[model samples]
Target: MLLESLSPLSGMINLVLVLLSVLTSAFTAAVGVGGGVLMIMALAQVMPAAALIPVHGMVQLGSNVGRTAMTWRHVNRAMLAAFLPGVVLGALAAAWLLVRLPAGVLELSIAAFVLFTCWGPGLPKRALGRGGILIVGAVTTLLSSLVGASGPVVAAFIKQSQEGRLAKVATFSACMLLQHLSKAFVFGVAGFVFRDWLPLMLVMVAAGFVGTWLGLRLLHWLPEHRFDNLFKWALTLLALRLVWLGGQRLAGAG
Candidate 1:
């Protein structure tokens, strides 16, 4: 019963998930974003439905921590400083409310958000003050607790604030790391048992570290314009997939 609860899949499917983790992490590392969404999408196909958010959160927490550590010098300390207060407020609110999403709502909402961040008229480039950053942080953190990955939202805000690619990636990774941290804490407070899947998560995180290393190497060779185009296309495809998944689930229920 313990094994069944922890790993609903056969050994082969577990191997596939670990491989997916590596590829997804590397992809995120190279393009400076989109890996966590990809990983969760794939995980949803294999893992038990109940474990999706918490397991994904832990895997991304490890992966982003790796990316942030590798590029710590480029992180925007001022921005993170402003974001922390909002994260605290958001986590507290999420824990207190204990909001459980209806089946299709979370996926569809994430799809819409990803599309907007990828293609919609972006937020103005003006640097947000502390208060603005705080609000953004709170909103993203709150949403992330529900959906599992808020990388696109965090990326959009970080893109507006930072000028260079390295700065953007570094700071964005830092912000996500913190968001995952908040999520883990919230789940713990809410009585989600994270230890059930610790073994699989550790293996996936190790694979993600390798992927992040390879992705960083590729990041240097890829031209900026080329990377931008690839990033946009990848995000669009993922968003479409999410929309389809949500629609199918809703249709089945109706």
Candidate 2:
């Protein structure tokens, strides 16, 4: 009797998670930050720690890749030319950073990146030189891997590029798609369980399709300058929460 009662509750909980996943994707699409960060909390609450981050990485990657593909032409190619090489450097750094440092440190650093992203009004009105953009890309991606929240950081750079809203989303999405791919490789080498995650992956990817489709339609409707500010603020809170979680873990380790 006890088991059966809990079983019904368990099913309800899972149904809620599935719905939440869809909304999370939609939220990020609308505001320009935080699909994975929200999903992290949801997954951790329901699953073992071992499966939480890495599994979430896979789902997030698929979503970002699809969004980028949808907005491919709008991406600022000049900025990408400056930024993508540094992403490769950042990816190479992920192997060392992921294992040697504590998760708490990574989380805190990532939160800090979001805070930086939040501080600005929405990218510098002043133009960054090509070299500056490249440096920003490498450092941001490196920090993102160490800190583990690449979206806001990437968004900030895209905003700084002043690529306009359409290009902002597209360029940010493309950069993130690459960044996540790097992180995925690192996790794969770390040997997290992927086979068991196939179903969840399918669900998140499908949600991404819906979210991106709706978000693109909505993007046309958003007023200029407003969404950028909103995106930064949203990223700030998400970053702080990750840092707090990391700090707690580090405290426990000590």
Candidate 3:
């Protein structure tokens, strides 16, 4: 009967993903990064390949919106101005090219990019002025479409501005919320029906809000140095798994 239903996933797997969404949200809230990527990695295991990005985008949109609401006062308005236009441009471009990517390529590319962001060489420390931030917005948003989550990339850009932790987290959440909103709009206009997934997505989002609250509390107790190390190591291991899985898929396709 589980298999006979019209649900996008079996009841068991759906329940598991809902739980994982909470846990992952907590992880990111505590560490200031990694939750979205981790959630996508888990979803990739059971979600149909074609539905992955859009569904992931919607969930992240909700997650980040919740975070943005919590940290609204800390957001950087100036940076937001520079970043939004690029988001629109990037979303439009992605909408036009929304052809289904080969699953192997999509997975492998995301894995490689995640690893690069986690362990890759640091970008030059120069301040990217308005024009520069705009460019960062465009480029990273474009990459986000392919990879589903590019928090690290956007965070790196925000870091360059040398904002303190609260501003950094708040601004990052605001930027991502806008970007994800743009992505969702593009997907909708592109004719991807999202109605069926709405029920599950709403549940995951409610769970994510709970996780975010708990994670923020945990963050108050966690030292930055230890959290950073743990976050990177965890993401690195996940990336390696993605690489292996992606490679296997590619080989099978060949």
Candidate 4:
């Protein structure tokens, strides 16, 4: 039964991923972002392309749920309310279009935006308001549907907000929970078989919760100034990685 549930992955590989989920979840919980991007990148190495996004979404949904539950008090309720509509809009748009963009172009676009958001001038207050968050919801969800990890983009946008570290992490996790939830629905409607992957996903999510608990403790210990620097550098590195990937893809295509 265990082997059957894991399907294509061998027992050893399944074990490895479960362990990785804990580490990656902790990293994201402590750092306030980048964990999902790291998780998806690792998944891509071992998972079939067709199963990658949906599986990643399912796992991430669980991880974010853990984080959100632990930090629910810190979430920005008003922002979350605004972002929900966008999630619906974006999911509907993705389901309606059902087209994949050229991966290279999408990667490059996302990378550039992440870099600019990290280093560029801060967005005006107006652009970070309810209207802006709604737009962010739609665009990030659509991009996430295509690319599998829009966490960086969403984190970048949330980084612009004036919320404290805990609030930012909490709210980001809440937003991601919604995005991943929408993703599951979209993929289910498209006829992906999630049941075959359920056992592994369940174990991974449980591991991620353990990691989230540890990470939140670390988050409490870290100095605020250090966290700000770490968060920016972490985003910068992830964006650079995206740039490298995009370049490789375009070059290969050329």
Clashing pairs in 1: none
- How accurate locally, in lDDT, is each candidate? 0.80, 0.69, 0.76, 0.90
Clashes of 3: 0
Better of 2 and 4 by TM-score: 4
Name the better of 1 and 3 by TM-score.
1
lDDT value, residue 207 of candidate 1: 90
Q: List the residue pairs that clash in candidate 4.
A: none
Most TM-score-accurate candidate: 4
Clashes per candidate, residues 3 or more apart or on different chains: 0, 1, 0, 0
- Cα shift from native, residue 132, model 3 (Å): 2.2
TM-score of 4: 0.96
lDDT assessment of candidate 2: 0.69
TM-scores of all predicted structures: 0.85, 0.78, 0.81, 0.96
Model 4, residue 63: C-alpha shift (Å): 0.2
Q: Over the stretch 148-173, how does candidate 3's per-residue lDDT look in tens digits?
A: 75676676566556345667667888
Expressed as tens digits, the lDDT of each residue in 1-254 for candidate 4 is 56445757888789889999999999999998888988998899988998999999999999999999999999999999999999999999987786666658888888888898889998889989999999999999987886785898889889998468898799999999999999888898888999878888999999999999999999999998888888888899998998999899988888
Off by over 4 Å in 4: 1-5
Model 2, range 109-181, lDDT digits (tens) per residue? 7667567656745444443667777766777666655445566656655655654667777787777777777
Candidate 1 residues 1-254, lDDT tens each? 43233354677777888888889889888887788887887888877777888899889999999899988999999999999999988888888886766667776887786687677786654437788789888978988887765677677666656766678778988988888899888889878887778878888889999998999899878887787777667667777777887888888777
Clashing pairs in 3: none
